[model samples]
Target: MTDMIDLSVATRRMDRVLDGIGDEHLLAATPCTEATVGMLVDHVLGLTLAFTAAASKDFEGLTDTPPTLPTGELPGGWNDVATARLSALADAWRDPDAWAGTTRAGGIDLPGEIAGLVALDELVVHGWDLAVATRQPYACEPDEIAACLAFAGTVSDEQRTEGALFGPAVSVPGDAPALHRLLGLTGRDPSWAPPG
Candidate 1:
């Protein structure tokens, strides 16, 4: 069994990023090529709900379907809704049992431990995506970044292609910071910025 990771820090960081996003940034491009800023927020909301269900071993609608590109519209009071869901997601995974069984997320059945890591990775990476797209500062703790790095490092070319979990891994220097390496492994350039 893997060490249980506390998701509060990542969730709180994402909440801060969400707070900084304004209406003007909605149509802006994000690091995720398939999503605009608004779409990415929608995706986050969906994934937050889906992965929370996964933590509870609830294999229902959200867990059964793979996520598609989101429409670029946010629900009324989406920030409050998203924050609540993110909090629930963190709280769900704090239970040791949540990491002890098989769970389904994005229509793929995998071990609970792996699913937790995936959830963490989503929060960390997408948090960065939203931050950069909105011109906000982003910071994640070293331990959280390390955990995500370990998970991202394990993804192979075949898994990446088949699962569509990431783009082709970008090459970063061996001596780069852990976050940069994790970003590279997840197919993002550390220096990526919105188009001028």
Candidate 2:
């Protein structure tokens, strides 16, 4: 069996990114072509809740529904809500049981271990997206990046279709940093920035 990963690093990085967002940055373009800063934050908020539920083996409601790009204004106090949920997500996964059972997230039933890796990938990648959109510095630990890279590498070509969770892998130098490689595998340009 694979060792369980610690989620604190990814969660803390996401929290710091959340702290840097301001009202003026809400409409800024993100590396994710389909979402602006506000929409992505909304998605983060939803995913935090869904994945936390998945960690607890609670498969109803949030876990059953796949996330969509939020089109409306963020909820009041969304920052606090997101931060709290992120912490909860990390905490929920610390239980050994979470990594041992079948769990569902984003409406797909998957192994608990795979679901945990998916949650980490979301936090690490979306943390970068939010940081870049808000013009904040982003740093991910090597272990977190490696874990996400491993998960991203498992995405099949068929899963890269339109509207899929990941897109076609972008080309990056073989010697590129692990974070860059991870981003490339997830179909993101590592050097992407908000439009001027």
Candidate 3:
């Protein structure tokens, strides 16, 4: 149940960040890259939902299935998707271990331990993304950052080459707070903003 607890706390933190933002700013694009505030939030929420879905269901073709963004009728937008995803995550958390089964990544079959680790990493990094999108300062708790750093260190060289998901290769200072410096290395400027 530790994994469930971790995910719950992480999701709550993100929820707090998102809930703090006014609707006007949810559409703002940060200075980072192509993703607007909505897209980035979608990316994070989408990933979380995928993980939760994997845990919940055993569809053999899931990886091949492209995810559709959640939306509503009549000019629906990011908020709709975010709200739906968050609700899904909450539902998933309620019975996390029920889906605590094997998963695959990079063609490597993963047991519950590896899958939980992956989920943990998601909670940490996406927490940072949420902060950047909302322009809210988040100081990663020491234990959580240390745990993520440990996982980051173990990421295979092949995985690192896949993309910016593991973020920049440079090492974050052991002393630096996990959330800020780690997000910085991952190309997310927590302070980033668009032109007014």
lDDT of 1 by residue, 69-174 (tens): 7897899999999899999999999999989879999999999999999999999999998999888888889999999998987888877652377778989999
lDDT of 2 by residue, 88-174 (tens): 999999998889879999889999999999999999988998998888998888888888888888889888854567878889999
State the C-alpha lDDT per candidate: 0.90, 0.88, 0.57
**Candidate 1 residue runs with Cα over 4 Å from true position:** none
Question: Residue 105 CA error for candidate 1 (Å)?
Answer: 0.5
Give each model a TM-score: 0.97, 0.96, 0.69
Give the better candidate number (2 or 3) by TM-score: 2
lDDT: the better of candidates 1 and 2:
1
lDDT of 2 at 147: 84
Better of 2 and 3 by lDDT: 2
Determine which window of 10 residues in candidate 2 has minimal summed lDDT: 158-167
Residue 156, model 2: lDDT of: 95
What pairs collide in candidate 3?
none
Residue 140 in candidate 3 has what lDDT?
A: 58
Q: For each of the candidates, give the backbone clash count.
A: 0, 0, 0
